[model samples]
Target: MAWTWTLETAAGDVIRRSEDFESRGDAESWIGEAFGDLVTDGVDQARLFEGENEIYGPMSLHADE
Candidate 1:
């Protein structure tokens, strides 16, 4: 199955949505590359929604400024 990444802000705001990939790793790498800066800027909240039932995050990370 393909993996999809959906990123959102702490307040439930959608920031970026990526195309489906063959692997979850690919999807995550895309998320990191696209939003790593925002994440490092102390925007520590995000969610990875995979499907209707498989939302994978609210992960808080320290993103460098």
Candidate 2:
């Protein structure tokens, strides 16, 4: 199954979806590295998916205050 992520705001509005990944691990790693940039772009959360099925998230991009 192809793995991907949906970038979104804190209010749950989607900004965009990421490029397709071959595996879940690769998708997760890419997010870990790119989330800094995403946050700067106004993304407050990310949701992981395997095709149309959500695997996890709405994970926060902000550092806990």
Candidate 3:
């Protein structure tokens, strides 16, 4: 199984995915570094998944700027 990240808008529409990762930690790490830029680019939240199973998130990445 692999993990992935999804970036979504405030309206809950998905914008992108991190493709796949062999480890959840790697997926989380990628998102950690990416969320800031994603927010700036108009993404409002993030979600994590393991295969087809939702693991966590839709957590806010939005920041006042």
RMSD of 3: 2.1
Sort the candidates on TM-score, descending order.
Answer: 2, 3, 1
lDDT, candidate 1, at 7: 57
Question: Looking at candidate 2, what is the lDDT of residue 13?
Answer: 97
Per-residue C-alpha lDDT of model 2 across residues 19-60, encoded as one tens digit per residue: 999999999999989988998899999999999999998899
- The residue pairs found clashing in candidate 3 are none
Top candidate, metric TM-score: 2
Better of 2 and 3 by TM-score: 2
lDDT of each: 0.63, 0.94, 0.84
Q: TM-scores of the models, in the given order?
A: 0.57, 0.95, 0.86
List candidate 1 segments past 4 Å from native. Answer: 37-44, 61-65
- The candidates, ranked best first by lDDT, are 2, 3, 1
Question: Which prediction has the highest lDDT against the true structure?
Answer: 2
